[model samples]
Target: MRFKSLKGIQDILPPETYIWQHLEHTSRKVFEKYGYKEIRLPIIESSDVFTRSIGETTDIVEKEMYTFPDKGNRSITLRPEGTAPFVRAFVQHHLYNEPSPQKYYYMGPMFRYERPQAYRYRQFYQIGTEALGTEDPKLDIEVISMLANILKKIGLKKFTTEITSIGCKECRPHYKTALKKALKNKLNDFCEDCNRRYEFNPLRLLDCKVPSCVKARTVAPAIIDFLCAQCTHHFETIKHNLELLNISYVVNPNLVRGLDYYTRTAFEVTSEALGSQKAVAAGGRYDRLVKDFGGPPTPGIGFAIGIERIIPLIKKSIVHDVYPDLFICSLGREASDRGFIMTEQLRNRGLWVEMNYDELSLRSQMRKADRIKAKNVIVLGEDELKKGKILIKDMQNKKETEVALETEEILKAVSNKK
Candidate 1:
């Protein structure tokens, strides 16, 4: 019998894992620059966190979430998205009590039950950030510009920023009424999902990607037009501030968050290289969520970058392959034992070192070292061990420097060369 990974799940192997690390490292630098701290949250939460925050009417709650009952009969779910869980944590921990706008960033896998395709998976990863307790329009612009900076730093040169305001509670009712009236006659032309969304969450109708639904929504009312005075000014300020940062964006009236909690200033950054899965990162404001979760009145905004979606579009020029700094090739049992100690010593000094345990010939071990592209190599055998000295071979220049066999000597040799 054989066991294999479940469907829609993948093992991120070498070279690829290097890219993931690179993306995370680069993202952390940019996030820290914007005064956002890292927050680690659990992968599972009470099902209500999402149902209430993301909306029971949306596809995620109705069709996609990995939900089930635990042994305690409590309904639990693997988080389908980041914001809901984040808000739940904020309220539960009283993070709101500490500051006006607590900023946090998180990176980890997110689970969903959707069918796997190109970049879509049942188990995927996201890099997300949330700014809680503030609704200043300037913060919105800064968040959007920060996303643009991350993409730019990651070498994603071609991406479009689509911004929109999904008017807050005061203005959404009027737009929902207008949108429904415009699409009512053509309900028959829309997909089944859109029809359901029309009655429950009409804003989602504009978000449908089905050909017929897309066509039917052409006449639907734009949410921006219905923005209340406050929301209108908020949206306008986002645009103007973005310009001040020299960031380009498009006001996409059709853009709307699938979640119910989002209020005002929604945006997405997309790349044409992704085809149908175009959005690499997206987020919006959710001002009422903290209060709804039993915390004090607070506002929040955030975005999640689908790591899988962005990985494919990352330019090859920026990603680098990881290789060992030193390969210790051992010939015999005694030499292998010595090489093992030396390898650990080098690694403890913050060097990437590799070695083969099998009693392969010197020629074979050297070949393996070359194949791994080690920066330097050291051969360990009876002859070198007896003399208490070894040759450090520089792989690139093929220069050999003889050094004492002691760990400190080898450490100094590599550290100096590096």
Candidate 2:
């Protein structure tokens, strides 16, 4: 029997990984500019961490999480998302005690058991940021603006920002009742999953992918109609601040996010380039998440971008190649051994170099270098080793010359050309 990887999982092989590296580097630079620090958390956590913070009725808790029992019969789960684990770390590590508003950004894999299509996978990566311990509406505006800036930076031009407020705890119940009444007679026409959502989390019905549910909710009551005085004021302030920053957006009443932790000011960036599953990034304010995780009363707002979705969009829009700087090609056993050392030296100088040490022929090694799109080829033959010099070939210009293999001379040759 041939074994295969589990479905809905993908391996990010070499050539495609260049896109990921670019995205990660850009994300770190933007987050640092906003005064956010990187935080790493466990990929697996106790099951209760998500159930308590993400809400039991949410799809992530009820249907999607990958949970199992350990040797001690305690339930542990591979995290289905990033926010809940970070919140747990925030409280457990006592980060809240040090500052009023702690900003953190994280990028990693999250697991969920769901049908895979297009960019949706059982194990996928996300880039997210969280601002904890602030209730100011300016924080909401900042979070949304940062997300928009990232999308623009990534070269996604034909995208739209859809903004909404799901209302706070005080007024959500009223909207829930109104939403339920609108779907009461037409419940059977919707999918079974949405039928269950009606009883537990009626708001998620707006985000349903089913054609029947979407058509039925066309005239349904929006959450904006039921917002309490405070939530209403906060939503308006977020919009006003967005206007001040010249960020264009459309108010989407039916934009409740999948996670239950979100309280107010939910937003998503969608692109027509990705059909059906159009959302490349989405998030909202979860004001009560910290308190739910046994921390102080801290209000937080943030966003998470689906790396898989964004990478595809970027590939379509951008035209650039990420290639190795140098390819160290060697002949004979002695030259191959010295080639490894030369590769390490070049790498220490912040240059990407590649070489294979299985003692392949000169022609085979050169072919491999070409496949990797190496900019220059450094030939370390027995003759060059004896002379303490090497032949350097500029692959792009098709020029060859002899240069001293010493560190200083090689550095000067490469640096001067650039």
Candidate 3:
């Protein structure tokens, strides 16, 4: 019998995984610097959480989520995104009790049953962050600044951000009414999806890509125009703060994010490397979500970057030249044991070390070290054991050095260069 992975799901193997690890590693570095601790949530959650929070009218809840019933007939679904589950945990743990504004980051796979495309899949990975309990527009600027730094750090050169203000609860109704009125006669001209959108979720009219729908969106009302004084001030202050931070952005009226929870501020970052489906990351403020989820009113904002999309755009060749600090080449029985011991000691000291073992001749052992591009190669043979010394060769310089069998002696020499 033959079996394969389900369609739209692909395995991440070596060379490719090298890039994934690099992105995750660098995310930790940048996120931690911005004071975001990592959070891990269950991959599955109660289905209503998403339907209620994401809005049943949104495509994610209405069409794309992977949901099924358990033996008890309770519906459980694989999370299609990180935010809702993150909030569920926040509410479950009552995180507000610990701090006023808590920031957390996460990296994991997300599931969606949408048609797969370049840099998108039914199952994909995402690196996301959530800053809870703060409504200051300054936090918006900080989050944007953090994303820019992360993008730069990962060597993503072909990307830009588009920012906008989506009217809040106090303001969105005006825009929605105006947008619907503007589309009254043109409702039939919209795509089939937007036809339903007009009746169910008129705000999503701007999200459609069908030519007629897109053209209709061109005439649609802008949320920014309807922002109430408070929302307007919040949006304006964030823009000013962004300018003060020297972060550039484009004002996109049609950039209302796909999520129903977003309010006041919305933004998307796109990459040229990934053609028309260009957004690599997107997020906005959702001040009403905490209360929507049964918690006291709390303001929050965050973003999620598609690993599949970002990896394709990153110039990973420049990320880092990974190599073992040392490679141990052992030829005899006694030498193998000692080499094994030396390997552990070097690793404990935070040095990446590789050793040649099994089915490898001395010549082949050397090749293995070169294959890994180890900086230094230690030759442990019978003669060297009797001599109470080992030979260390620097592959790059083709230089040789000798030291006593004591591990510290080798550590001293290696630590100096590293």
What lDDT does the true structure give each of the candidates?
0.90, 0.87, 0.88
Backbone clash count, each prediction separately: 0, 0, 0
Ranking by lDDT: 1, 3, 2
State the weakest 10-residue window (summed lDDT) of model 1: 313-322
lDDT of 3 by residue, 1-418 (tens): 4999998999998778888888999989999888899999999999998999998877799899999999999999999999999999998899877677799999999999999888779999999999988899988989988998898888888688999998788888988899889999887788887887687678778877788788867778778888999989999998998888898898888886778899888888997778877989999998989888888899999999999898877745544577898999998788899889989988887888899768479899888889889999988888889999987889999898999887788888887788
Instruction: State which candidate, 1 or 2, has the greater TM-score.
Output: 1
Model 1 CA lDDT for position 402: 98
Model 1, 1-418: lDDT tens digits are 4998988989998778878988999999999998999999999999998998888877789899999999999999999999988988998898998767799999999999988898998999999999987788988998999999998888787999999999999999999999899988999999987787778788878878899888878898788889999999999988988888999999899887777888998999999998888889999998999999999999989999999998888747554766888999998889999899888988998999999978898898899999989989999889999999999999999999999999888888887887
Candidate 2 — worst ten consecutive residues by lDDT sum? 409-418
Compared to the true structure, candidate 1 yields what TM-score? 0.93
Better of 1 and 2 by lDDT: 1
Q: Which stretches of candidate 3 lie over 4 Å from their true place?
A: 317-320, 332-352
> Evaluated with lDDT, which candidate comes out highest?
1
Give the RMSD in angstroms, all C-alphas superposed, for model 2.
3.1
Residue 239 CA displacement from its true place in model 2, Å: 1.3
Best by TM-score: 1
Residue 6 shift from truth in candidate 1, angstroms: 1.8
- Candidate 2 vs candidate 3: the lDDT winner is 3
